[model samples]
Target: MTTSRSFVLICTVGIFCFISYNMVRMPALSLFAESLGAGPERIGLIVSVSTLTGVLLKLPSGALSDIYGRRFLLRIGVVAFGLPPFLYPFITSLDALTALRFLHGLATAIFAPSALATVAELYRERRGAALGTYTACTQSGSLLGPFLGGYLIHAAGFSTAFVTAGVFGCVAMVLFYSLHLDVSVPQRKEQGTAAVLSEMWKGFSVVAKNTKVLITSVTDAAKMIANGALMAFLPLYGVSAGLNPGEVGLLFTVQACTSFFSKPIMGRVSDRMGRQPLILLGLSICAGTFVCIPHVSMFPVLLLLSAGFGFGEAVVSSSSSALVADSSEFKTLGAGMGMQGTIMDIGHASGPLLAGLLIASLSYPMAFGVIAGVQLLAAGVFWVTMKRM
Candidate 1:
């Protein structure tokens, strides 16, 4: 396939896969777990179990992709995304749903690194913009998923929502299957299991030693901590502040819309102006907005804060993936991305858990402030580390 066709296909796959994934992620998953008699702790665990899958599988999946091939893992990942929601309606307990969420998490674990690696290889010169655009496509799914899921659940029911999500997932799988590519890197020919392990270890070692990749990934993790906290608690907080369900949902939409619009632009800017500056700027914006979230109860002000956080997120994310790609050896790009994914998932999982603890023990304002402080410290460490680079 022509490069353009391949790019379009890949981007479309990103959009639909995320749409399917997120449709069950936000309001739907939490509400579903609640209906199954889950408490706040159980619900938090259920929500984070999917990320735990990414944390476990991403590095090895990525290394395997580097040694074997992208398409093979990509296909498996798509299957994971496409096939899982059909089983949601069968879930009779929180345990069943949690197990399914972990299984569904495998989709992102295998797909994200492979997909980013493919984009990196395909547009080496214009990688920042390409990665940003691809991420933005996924963000579009995020933009739509919560609102769509919330509406469906309210109007129809959980079963219908899951079924609709399944349909989107199948559509994504079909689009992914049709792509033809000459873009994949030549695979290593290892004769035995031991040889494969050796190659995989080499890939891991290469990414492990890259200071630039490690530092940038850690900073990105800090950002995701704030993001995860918001995802877990924002709706509750909004409702507590007198906003209706629709208004609470709109907050997420505004944030996603800002990110969808800003990522590609920020990515191109990173390509031209250098990534470090934007990463620093974005972190500061994220920290500031996050700290302010608990300070305002007004919808317009909250909306602005949410949008600011989203724009900051777009700036950081658009650069971070490209930076990892830049820092990695050409052959180990997948492994490097996998490392980033794993670390980011760790932060993502931690976010909700820690927030739950803090909010339980203290006030929302205090919990948010402390999280924002972590981001500030991350920015400092990132600045200091990158200065030597």
Candidate 2:
């Protein structure tokens, strides 16, 4: 029940929960949609529907956490993560798949902000490092999930992969329910529905008006735009380039591995050096690496690009979340984190749709180059905005 113990438990739960979530996400989801006869545009829709759920719900969920409690919302989130993978095996059409993905999106929309606020509260003195480590734990899921999912799909087929993902999710649910989290919930004398709604709205108003939080979040969203694009198209691109599904999965694993290793180190550095420089540097690195992805067909070269992009991601993420925490009021911490999530999801959802349109009309190289350009432009705007502030 100590803070350290609670942090560890949360991180552990995050690992299993994300592993469950990602196994269904990567190469598997796109490939499954393809089997259902989807084109690039429809595939993009299926992939982005989940993120759209986050755009609509993350801020409200975060605000509600401030009024209700982190644990209460977290329980719902784990259940969301746990139960949905079981239905993937039954999905027969693109419409069913897209609907299921949106329903599944509720897991992260509800869980992420509360979990982040809890970590920020737990280690107020070294939020960068603490948040980095926690996020790295979740990144471990990203590292392993694709590899397992890809292997399952290649060896056994989609049903086995989905069922296995469900098992991991169930494990997370059980662990979360069994452990007693020691984090304190805010005490409110008014338990009326109207009072709760008013409190939630106040949290929203405060977060919306915070310029620093908004800027930091928008910067993070720029990076997520590229991440989302890669998640949607990289597998198909890799396969087209002569890599198998397993190899495609490894590409993602390598990218995630680089991020997993770098986040804590970069986070500690950010804690001492300040966040703005790292954010700008990370964006530049992301732009440089991302624009090069489509110019190469070699597996080794693609892996290198993936790793570089991942490091850039680590650098940005390690600083951005901590920066948002630093800029928020303690009372509305959940709402601040939620606001960031909402903006990031908006960018995330747009990435696939935009990339799909571009790739369909132009080429892969052009699509990636344009998205990378967006990152650089965002960095320039972020730099000027931060300097003036």
Candidate 3:
């Protein structure tokens, strides 16, 4: 492969690893914290706090990518993402775990938007196709992580699993730097901090003011909220419904693989069909699927239910990022990606926390049922604004 191709491939794979490192530990963390005497609310706090940091940091990280260059900024994120995994195995207290998680969140903040910017930069004209292939790596990682975690935990222990994650993260970091991605190096050929900040704010301001940006960003935010619930509550829901860990793991695998495989196709279809119809369809399916989950107790029935969320999400995620990139000007791409990250993080930040609260006060069915409503509401917003567009 050419150097450029190699660079893109490697960096994309590294992004996969970063996501994997963040997620694979999730089930384990829940178990660990519970064993350490943390309650459901505390576990929610631990997860939410980490997301809160990512929410806070995405914009700055994007602006930093804009000013510093994608390559250099990503390098920093890789290190940040990697270091926390190492610490995971050693931490004892929930408070310490929260602190480590917060640090780990910084890595996500750094790696994702910058890496996205790099992907957007690579195939500027084919935004959907480009992002689909790139983002699919993340989905694939999401698929592998839990599967890997499930087996590892059953076999060795959570400590071993944590250390394994750290090792993979370190490898991903090394591979990332070695690939020498062509993304810009953050440094001033001729610009001061004030100018850079001004440009960053300008990007944010522009996106906020644009109607398309607002609607699409909101659409994405809603999908992320559902995603957040899926990640945080799905396993619990499965367990509550009497799924063994193996069945639960199988559900994750199917959803993730379906989502992963479907991305490029959805991206292409969205390009041809226009974003609105696909958005509406995807959201409707998601909402319908959520309602199904509460009803299905059989393993096969639940697996099909899980597929609905996955398929809907694949369409939304691939198309939404493409839309965000499409709506933004080229010069402000970094800021645009940052804006996308920031908006989605709002829902992402709230999903698990809100779901946990609902589960605590109400029930898992009620919590996820409300999420379905949110999905429908997001679809409505898209339909109204999209018609105007």
Candidate 4:
């Protein structure tokens, strides 16, 4: 393989490690905080604050990658990403935890945009397959994390699980450092603030005006909301229904296994069959499956729903990313992906909190129902917009 391809694979493996590191701690943060004498409100603040920071910063990071070189910005992500997990054990107060979470969000803001920007640069000609492979790597990392955590927490406790994530991240950083790329963020000879703003505005303008991207972003955002709930709430949901930790872990496995294969298949199909139809079908399936989720409580039902959810997300995630990369220039592709991440993060940030609230007041079914409805609407939007494109 070429250097860039090898680099992409290395970065992907690091991402896998990163998710494996964080998966257990993130989903179980509320429980971990509870052990530390925090309640839902505190956990909410910690989680939301971090999420909010990441959501808002994607745009600037993308712009920076465009202007400053993907290498510099990616290094920012590596340091930010690799170092944060070490500090978790040092957090003695809720405020400290919340502050760390916010800082941690910067890792995603920097890394995802820059890393994805690398793929966009190397695979510009075949992003559907390339990003499919890329996202699948992340899903694989996410897949491994919870299972590792569930087992590890019993053996080592929460702090071990949390601190270990940082250590694993160092492994990823080392690999990321070794990989080389051909693209540098376009450099300028000392431009004015107005010039920078104009450039940023132009990126936003393309995001707003492009039909393929608008549809792709909106639809994928909706799909992420559904997934956000599943990843965020499945453990509670499993326990509430009287399932064991093993069972809960299995659900994650099912989702991951299907999604692992879903991307590569979807990518080849999109290349052969076309992007829009596949995107539309994926969203419809995803929405329908989420609607079926709340009603399921048995082992068979859980397995089916997990696979369904995985299939839906896998299809949409790869397709939408490729579409976004397709829609923009190399100069702003990272920013474009960042904008995509930002939009998706909005749905992700909202999905969990809303599900928690709904589960408290209404029913789990209601939460899933609402998410499904949003996705259905999004599917429509995708079709209409893609038709125009």
The prediction achieving the highest lDDT against the true structure is: 2
Worst 10 residues of 4 by lDDT: 20-29
Q: RMSD in angstroms, candidate 2?
A: 0.6
Residues 128-181 of candidate 2: C-alpha lDDT, one tens digit per residue: 999999999999889999999999999999999999999999999999999998
What TM-score does candidate 2 get on C-alpha atoms?
Answer: 0.99
Candidate order, TM-score descending: 2, 1, 3, 4
Cα lDDT over the full model 4: 0.73
Local error of candidate 1 at residue 337 (angstroms): 0.7
TM-score of each: 0.96, 0.99, 0.93, 0.90
Which pairs clash inside model 2? Answer: none
- Tell me the tens digit of each residue's lDDT in model 4 across 1-389: 58466556645745645564455444455556556776434544555555677688987788777777777887777777677777777777877877777888787777777777777787667778877887787777667766666555656676777766767677777766776655644758769888877877877776666666656777788887777677656766776787755567677777877998889789877777777777788888888888887787897798898888889888788777887887877667877888888888777777766666666678888878988889989888777766665
lDDT of each: 0.88, 0.93, 0.75, 0.73
Candidate 2, residue 202: the lDDT equals 93
TM-score of model number 1: 0.96
**Cα miss at 224, model 1 (Å)?**
0.7
For model 3, name the residue pairs that clash: 68-186, 69-186
At residue 372, what lDDT does model 1 achieve?
Answer: 97
Off by over 4 Å in 1: none
The residue-level lDDT of candidate 3 at 23 comes to 45
Query: RMSD to the native, candidate 3?
Result: 2.1
